[model samples]
Target: MMVNCCGLLTSQKEPVPLKSVEVELEVRDHVATVVSTLSYENKEDKPLEAVFVFPLPGDAAVCHFSAQIGQMQIVAEVKEKQEAREEYDDALSSGQQAFLLEESEQSPDIFSLSVGSLPPGESASIRLEYVTELAVQADDGLRFCLPAVLNPRYQPQGSGGGEGGNVQVTSVQVTSVPASLVPYSLSFSARVSSPRPVSKVESNCPLDPLQYLNTEQTQTTVKLAAGHKFDRDVELLIYYKDAHQPTAVVEAGRASSEPGTLMGDPVMMLSLYPEFPQAVMSSVASCGEFVFLLDRSGSMQGARMKSAMDTLLLLLKSLPMGCYFNIHSFGSSYEHIFPESVEYNQKTMEEALKNVAEMKANLGGTEILKPLKHIYSQPCIPSQPRQLFVFTDGEVGNTKDVINLVKQNSGSHRCFSFGIGEGASSALINGLAKEGGGHAQFITGTDRMQPKVMQSLRFALQPAVQDISVKWDLPKGVSVIDLSPPITALFQGQRSLVYAQLTGQGSEASEGCVTVRYSLAGHPSQNQLHFSLKPAEDTGLTVHRLAARTLIRSLEMEKREWRGQEDGGDKKKKVVELSVQSGVSSAFTAFIAVNKGNSEVIQGPLVRRNVPTPMVMACGMRRQCVPMSYDASPVMNMMALRQAEPCSLKKRSLPKQPPRDPLLQLVSLQKASGCWVLDPDLAAALGKTSEEVEKPKPASVNQEVWATILALIWLHGFKMDAQEEWELLAMKAVSWLQAQKASCVTECVDAGNALLGCTVQKDVLGL
Candidate 1:
């Protein structure tokens, strides 16, 4: 047995020493290319092998890996995973230096790297390179995260056992220590280039001041601050000016390949920002079945759970009177607010609000699969489209399985997903929305939940775009081969990227045009884009690689959909061939390196060591606790009850304050027109900022009606317990609302209820 510096394992032998690490990242537009170099030295007298388990972004596609032994550099080659493993084992047994890397079948975020048979006192340097798309935050800032912490995922009872039931329930060991105690040193730097001006760069970790490389402010460089330990995940948020503009880039293909092939042809990437007509925006359906699947796992404790509750309150209040709704909270198991979805009347809305307030993260572990299966098993109401809103910390291990299930049920409903907190799994959050044809939003740091949640609700309420088609008009000799799959969904003010291979190049002076045609709210609409045919300068194959990646993903998705059939084998083989040809690593192919110099067959028993990762300190848990484990027994009920005690204590320890009169507050906060402006002062009183309050507004809301509705909601929602004290002020607000004809009172009330989680009566307001 082998151990790591964190002391996560009990081993009889000494642990190997890991030296320093260097990281380099290049971010262009919304994609990131990362390279990491790890150095290791073996101080033992005998030859030794080192195995290191590490974390990576779940969606990253590893492109290159190589190892340096002494003065020899051996580059890796992509091959079938099992074949690569066999070759690596044979090389190690023959006393040749070899390196092997494989992603965990249990978790895509975890990877194991083996440096085998290093002679005593010899040092080996390993380099890895990967590319991943950066997710856009709700604020339109691009988010890039380097994961340094790996929290152990607990498998639920009766679930498929870990590693086929032979391995320990918790296969990976996680240890937590103070930042200063970490032995590893990290050096990271990034060069960012985008079409839009770089507004600013922010990070959770300390960073040096950003340096602009050009006068245009479109290119910049940033590095970590001095004395940064490899502790928490390194997160960078990059903001760009004019972020929503549509653009296109034409890239010259590889000069070394045949002209007819995909790599040898020119490629074009088009970014389309569709702007729906105002008439279409105002035509959203008022009735639908809204199902909420909330994660109540231990990881979602504290601020995450609070945010979910706030979001749920807004959703409950926003539902139309005739819409059907239900709420399901899940961890190890799930509990529903009602046996079936009920119409969103005053009674049901109030009941949901009360139950939502009591929802907690007392659930044991994140076991979302069963709850999702259950939700899909229920029948959807006719004429009312089903919209599923999932709020989670996104710590599930079976991400692919979950996404597959959602895809299988995509026809029945659309899924809008919210990823809460830092280091949430992008694979799960983004995959769910992508497969289910909906939008994805992430909430982190001090970001408010109202705007993002309400934006998704609006999307859900909008009628789906239909009859999508693309038509291209190019100069003579110019042909297009579509690289991306057909567009499945579109939303107003949202950007969609289409990539195509432009073969049989046209004249440099010629121009090409493309039009996207679709129907929104039963009205036919089309967007036309025109661009020069000239190839852009110095693109450096970024567009080509991205196009390849997109095609690979589409093919892989098809394979997953057709899995277990005869065609699955053909699809799998095609994916491997394409991956190898493009030098892109896939789920079926691995990069392997071997150093065959001085191949003397003298070797002892090779030691297999598992490196320990830093445990993520989450959910108010202390650092001294062991890594979380789940047993295949029915003890979760007791565990959940025990967990609730600490939560109750935490709640009780907060200092108590006398409740303020909400009606008096509302009256004091009202403007001169008997309306609330949702300005900074009023926003502060409502525990929000002016920016948050003003961000997400439906097209149908009128300022006057909205302000009056908010004022009335403030009085009704908070002062109901002391109605006698504020009855006069509430009546005045209701009268003001009744007098307003400038806006549709019904729409304003619905918007206010959705935002404030209040069920103010329209009839009482005489609207």
Candidate 2:
């Protein structure tokens, strides 16, 4: 059989060699700790070695790796990358089983695992553990994604070696396949506990009904539905009832470790959702130089380009009247709408909108670095802070270089980035915003681009939070030993996590408190959280490992800053020492395990095989579309529009039967209370089932608010052209919207407009 492994087609002499995979995830507060166990068997009648290249969340910090063969278990230890590789090679040559795990130097999201010299018919169980901070979505849900697909990244010509000259391990092109066709099974389960009540949980894949463990709903457990194939990426969205509340947790360190060390002390994780005064929010600057950078790369050729254009339209229209703006589109190269940023007048805005409408993903490869350099070279407008809005599918391989550039220029501008589509590189999207001191958002299937873009626009316009500090109040004997880096910036409603080591012994009854202080619009504000000194339940080494990851990240940032300078060596050494001490894998270190218990030395040349992984076709596409060359003529603009027309016309046209008229259907589905409830009938008209819509909403979501919003969206979308036909219904919606101040009607309308591609005036709705 010929198998598609990565981008290479190879003939396989046996059935799919890789077997089942099991994943155990534990989420505490805003961080998630994941343990993956892969079971593989050597079915061939010879010694075999396997190489598997897989994808992980870009920010994951791998902390543990071990292999179990028969009854012997060998735990891996963190070692310098080169040394680990050499040791593994020696073990393999000496007829010993060895396992090595190393992260790709070029892309943080990719990792290569090698399991060597497994005897015939013997099975090996490989277990790996990692820790990462879950990203908060625009709707305030915490998102945890396990990447099961590794789409081949397009590397442009003349790009040279990326960051380091790390050889490309594998190129896996996404291919469409039915779930049943996949050869492997996946079993996943997660335990979620938060300071705030766990309202609900959602997943892209089928999941068993959630089981709450406590009446307060502070803890819950969920697992994958039975007989689930390893098909698409596994995504879980968790919502907390009081997500914005400030909370503190102190985790006890490892008891067996010596005192005065990271493992010996208690660690406190502080989560702060800073609420800036409304006056400060309203005082955001109305004058700034806004530069919009759109990705025209080939990977963004379909719905992504359309979404970008739509987002650009919304952003261009929302800019302050007196702000200056410019638009740039880049692929292999870049083109600008204007020679430089011009005043946001009617003429400029109209011209930019026209150009954006005609924009297409004709640019060959994603070459963002050159254009970034060009943008940075331009002089900044006096007193008008530069804000860059980057829209991309985040397919670039030179992620580290791009982020470093953004970091170097952080002082001059703030960056807001959007990652388009499912396979978008989280590293690029999150790194750009993190290094540039701004915000990041990801848009996937059916996600309205406008609301997220507009939210980012509001963030860009907000005044910078300055003079941030954290103060600790504890008993005299208790002190903070190692503290994470100081807070660089803060935005309203965004949660900031701070990790610190609480050293020394204090009475369990003592009160420990922390206060976060920052300046907003020249006004000083502080948020204080108090907790007992008593250590929380034993979470093993989760807190310590998380703290180590934080410190390692800070050290890596410092290394980037000292890239070509003399201090680089010292920073590298420190990172290595910290990684080794904590058993966490870093850029300079890897995890290696070797088994020496085998009494009989069976020496033979092991057949090396690369294990294949299932590919996920791009969202909304049925087949993989090959990107045209850089010099190819532009086709995506016309093609996309043509393909979109059928759907548009279908949506606009009423059904042949009056009973099926979408507007009438929606009205018929509404309750006597004048709100369209999320019922099965209404969901069917919207091309979804009620269960799908209702399952994701937590107790925090007011059904009335959501139902009203849906009804308004339906009216604004399908009935806009025939308002006379539904004016009575529209009036009722308007009245209902007015009566309910519980929801932000204006924001809802904006979100609806963005999703439906309509420009409904908020003033018309009396918002």
The Cα error of candidate 2 at residue 463, in Å, is 2.4
lDDT by residue (1-767, candidate 2, tens digit) is: 75435522223423445687899999987889999999988877888887776778878889889999888999999998889999988998889899999876556777888899988889999999999989887678999988875544545445543211112432222222233345567889999998789988988778999999998999999998997766667889999987888777788877787778887788887778888888777554768999999988655776788767766765664566578999999977899999999998667877887788798777666779888999999999997889999998776666777888998898899999998866677878888998888889877656667667877877887898788888889899999965677777788898887888988889887998888898887788998888887777867777788788788766776666786888789889988888898887777888999897887775678887666555434333324232211112224422332233222234466546324446445654543234566677766766556766565444554676666666666676666665533444445455555676655555566655654466777776545
Count of clashes, each model: 0, 0
Which stretches of candidate 2 lie above 4 Å from their native place?
1-15, 155-182, 227-229, 282-284, 617-767
Candidate 2 positional error at 329, Å: 2.3
Q: All candidates' TM-scores?
A: 0.81, 0.79
> Model 1's lDDT to the true fold?
0.72
Question: Residue-wise lDDT of candidate 1 within 1-767, one digit each (tens)?
Answer: 64444522222234545666799999988878999999888766677777666678866777789988778899999897779889988998777888888766545566778788877778889999888777665467788988765554554555543421111212323333333344557899999999889999998888999999999999999999999876667889999998877777898888997797777899899988788888777654767899999999877777678767866765665555577999999987899999989887667776887798788787767888999999999998997789999998776667667887898898888999997775566667888888898888877657666668877887887888888999999999999999987877788776778999998867888999999999887789999899887889986767777777677667766765775698888888887876776667666767788887656653677655444445444555433332232222224422432344443355447657455434334444543234566567676666566766665455667655566666676666765655433443344455556566555667666766777777877775546
List runs of model 1 lying over 4 Å from the truth. 1-16, 104-109, 154-182, 282-285, 445-447, 598-602, 628-767
Leading candidate by lDDT: 2
